[model samples]
Target: MADRIVVAGVPVDTRHWIGGRRVASVETFTDHSPVDGQPIGEIARGGPAEAVAAVAAARDAFPAWAATPRAERARILHAIADGVDKRVEELAIVETTDNGALLRSHRRGVMPRVAHNFRFFADWLLRLDHDDFETRGHTNHVSWDPAGPCVLITPWNAPLMLATWKVAPALAAGNTVVLKPAEWSPLTASLLADIAAEAGLPAGVLNVVQGYGAEVGDALTSHPDVRRISFTGSVPTARRIAASAAANLTPLSLELGGKSPLLVFADADLELAVELAVEQYDNAGQVCLAGTRLLVEESVASEFTRRFVEKAAALTQGDPRDEGTDIGPNIHPRQLEKIDGFVQRALGAGARAVIGGRRKGGQYYEPTLLTHVA
Candidate 1:
């Protein structure tokens, strides 16, 4: 392993944020930068015991948070949003260094959306309306109530943005949260805990536990005190979490995998279609919503393929920190191998490569285009 390099200006201790404080763990794991396979720092390796502690903290905080006025919750949420906005550059750097995401993408796209999530939910809570109905001899009423302590398990691909997607609404609804960010990309989530504290989020309102899913995730999902579980990740993992939550009759909100297809019609703008197709290669084509499958009208297929291949071939792949770098390394060497294996299998099964179709180096895969694919 490359020599461990602690990130300057950020907490190196990857302790769990429980009850408004940092808690230590029994073991530790080294977090390495996927960009160049160098050690970033060591993170606390938590297990079921840590998960139980986090859940307990959130459960203890739920009643008070749930009773807080909607307007008050909105104010705190907005403050958190502002705090995130002020630290966008710093968070983006951490995300890039830990997860192999391009700093440019995180700074300009991901971080802004993360802040927007909080802001949007903050305003949304205030706009909520109640409904009542009166009949000849009966009355009906509808209301929204807090769901108590919730477990939010975010994926590695877009750790901070997706975590906020779950965290913002949960907090806006006055529910305490136990967030278990994917172990591969926990740095930004750790920073978020600090931001929440700085924004004056009450003790135990938001707790973060860092560790592998099998240990921390299993414990959280199965904990009886956790009322709701929100997860975003692969379908297989979602299934496992679902089964575990089912044992406790817990409510679940899962956003699983997708193989999004891009359709191009003869009347559609060719340039625009080509551009959209090129986007499938973004984030090294690791995105769940990427348009990996293309369905084009036979009339425009030839032109679209030609232009798409030309554009895909021109994309720059290098260090994620570079200002001009278009694509960064994969999340790790294993993911790189997986992408390569899939392409090679397709090619062997009859698919033909029109342009780039090879690995660049240790963790970089070329922007690939394949035709006649089954």
Candidate 2:
């Protein structure tokens, strides 16, 4: 396989990682960066065939990986963490270019968490215990075992961070993984495949199939041989995956989207409340857990909203790679349009945006605050 290469100022290995090796597809899709709507790289467009192959590879590697000692697994995981630390900058840059998240946020927070995920799980694995209980002069012991091959379908918002959140625990518990990253931001996940290989992990233990969810994702979740499935995305898509996995009775863990709200009382600190409110715009309001809806006490609602709009309007919206930028472009034009639709609908109903309600340009949407949303 060729060494990692840079395209359009982004480092990428735009191929499917199957059986611990980089494999290219006959057909490829160009990934355009949301930063400036420029081509970042051409990624292998894997379909059902690639998904099946990846699952088979994971199934093949499962026995040896499951039987491997817990200490050995911990060591390998630590090595993977080290690899992530070494290439944190490159990974951050690739994610920023691919997804238009703030580069500083990725460098300082998200990338570090990726490495930390591995290390945390590695340590946790060593600390895990089997418990025994005595009842009526009899003793019963309980233990856990590897569940077999797992399929991890991660979102694009925070690709490596979320992928590793699932990957670390699954691998640490001795189950091989077949990760299907969201198509919008797959570059960092590809980088992680390389890091795992270099960390001395065995072949077929980790596989990546990159493509649209309908093709690769459906193949993975619906596969008969899959033992477990973990997905983080929308409720509608989760429903689809659940239906697919039902055929095999596969165990599934899902983390879906919600309208998280932040509440502030009349006596609360106004400035701090305003700060937290503005933080909802972090990652250009793409954060799944962000408090998108704010509920303030009517007594202080006017003051809090005033400060929030002032701060939000002053936020820097520009290229993600720029250090001065606070908010980056939306992940894709379609996502931008969806956000606009929501804002417009709110306006049509009766609400008004005190700060912003329009797209700045290209993929950048203004930091908007809507009042009279009740």
Candidate 3:
């Protein structure tokens, strides 16, 4: 068995990547592997002051970067995508370790998509054309321009992918960015900073601040210099960020959490529905769009539940690094506890656990199914 995993050619001890350098903070925090609760590494603990510094760096870099021709920006973004492709395996392992996601999923699915995000944005930006319309004997030119010195706040679950979703577009659009990755999963983002630097991206074009939302996040959102704010997280936190953005009248894009429900009609294909439910339960149902609630037509409900439980029970739960493992540990102990509490409450309300319901040792929770839950 592997005792410990090291991020190849990357520092295990994560630090803020600001102005194209590894930055240290006055304080630091420990990052534990959710798989076994082992200390993986320590990361710099940034706060308001660090946020201010990152914003300043991005603000200073914005003018030169934005002035660079769009084609040139596209070239740099393509190079970044190449770098990501080269390091996909290493990045996959790093992300799996940091976020308790399956290595197989990261390697085969997420990493490729992340690389595509950069390349896609790069190509899209290159082909972009402005429109000119003649109206009332006058010409009106319409073009999409960079929003200067933007802030991107990504969540812990699928950290690198989501960060790239925001970062690639911002860079393609000619914006300098200050990214704040959730403290829980800073490893991959740090690696991404390194990759971007290696790809010859200009200094200060992309900066990452590693810390909690209350400190660094608040600072970034409210900073007067940060003209745009994009965030993906819980609803309450989104509200807080919205309020902060309001102070500067910053344009904002928010992707908040949702408990998506899957509906099954009598005419629906039972096999396909079961497959979809099984897919939903992947990632331990921790996804923001996870289909946690299921509503089925009465005629098909009983049969559907039976097959779903059988399929869910068959899913393997073990070390995420293992190829055969389907379900990995929850991101942390608190998440495990939260899942358990929710299950317990449903049971108290007279719900029946048709298959798995309790926590399976460590941070693992069994693939669970509850019926008669209102």
Candidate 4:
């Protein structure tokens, strides 16, 4: 098992970044690549102790960070964005290896968006649209204030990009953030911590704790010092965090997974409809916002399904590093099994598979399309 991967001449750091320093954990977990189920490195297995330390750090740093001028904060954010842009290729490769997404998509789309998240929010912060009015010759003003010590819990599917979506705004608003990236895909988050530190971000202004949601997540959300909680993941986990945060009355923002459908009208262009249907397989169908179900007008359903299946069948699944590979392995064996279970149950219920209905090998699942349902 490799301790860490060297990407673009840098040995990836896998330790927790707390108080602007790398902190080691007594207990650690082995991070495995979704591409081949191979061990990529050993990551610090943070728990309540680490979570408490991180929150304390954020709380200690909150006053100074919140008091920092908006202009200065924006400058630091822009610097962070510059760092991210410079390391896009490295981050993209690390993310693709850690989470098993398409390398090309990460390089061309997701990683760039990660940097953009910081840059856009930084500029927006300087352009505050505070409401002001004059009443009876007296001036009244409403302005936004920083909420201190925010906790951000991001999902494994698109770890860095989604984490930054929450991190950027919270930091831009002059709040200190403690980010807990999903245990399954933690490499890029660690990388981001390094980037922010190098960009001159104040110590403890941004901290990262890497561990399972059940352990570290519970600790961070439940901590009283945390003023806000932002999470992106499943509904059940969101519920747990909400319950934990209720004691402190901490403000919460939750982005949970929901079933999405693609509706195709009879008049829709056949080619475009088929293209949209095939897109459901993007990210190996792991995306929470993916259109998992298709509702097509019966008049063109047969032709649409035919083209969709043909396209799905033609997708090449292999190692994510390969430029020719379209689809990559599922993030883990358990997720692969879960997908197969869904397809098997559908087939058992009389749904007929038009394209794929079985596992190919290892962590790869067939891009299945089923019809003739009840």
The regions of model 2 sitting more than 4 angstroms off are: 1-5, 8-11
- Lowest lDDT sum, 10 consecutive residues, model 1, at 1-10
lDDT of 1 by residue, 193-265 (tens): 9899999999999999989988888999999999999999888899999999999999999998788789999
Model 1 residue 225 distance off true place after TM-score fit, in angstroms: 1.0
275-295, model 2: which lDDT tens digit per residue?
Answer: 998999999999899999999
| CA deviation > 4 Å runs, candidate 1 | 1-5, 8-12
What's the TM-score of each model vs. the native?
Answer: 0.96, 0.97, 0.96, 0.96
Clash counts for all predictions: 0, 0, 0, 0
State candidate 3's TM-score.
0.96
**Model 1: colliding residue pairs:** none
Compute the lDDT for candidate 1. Answer: 0.89
Off by over 4 Å in 3: 1-5, 8-10
C-alpha-based local distance difference test score of model 2: 0.92
Q: What is the lDDT of residue 272 in candidate 2?
A: 95
Write model 4 residue lDDT over 18-40, tens digit each, in one string: 99998888888888988888888
Q: Clash pairs of candidate 3?
A: none
Give Cα distance to truth, residue 343, candidate 1, Å. 0.7
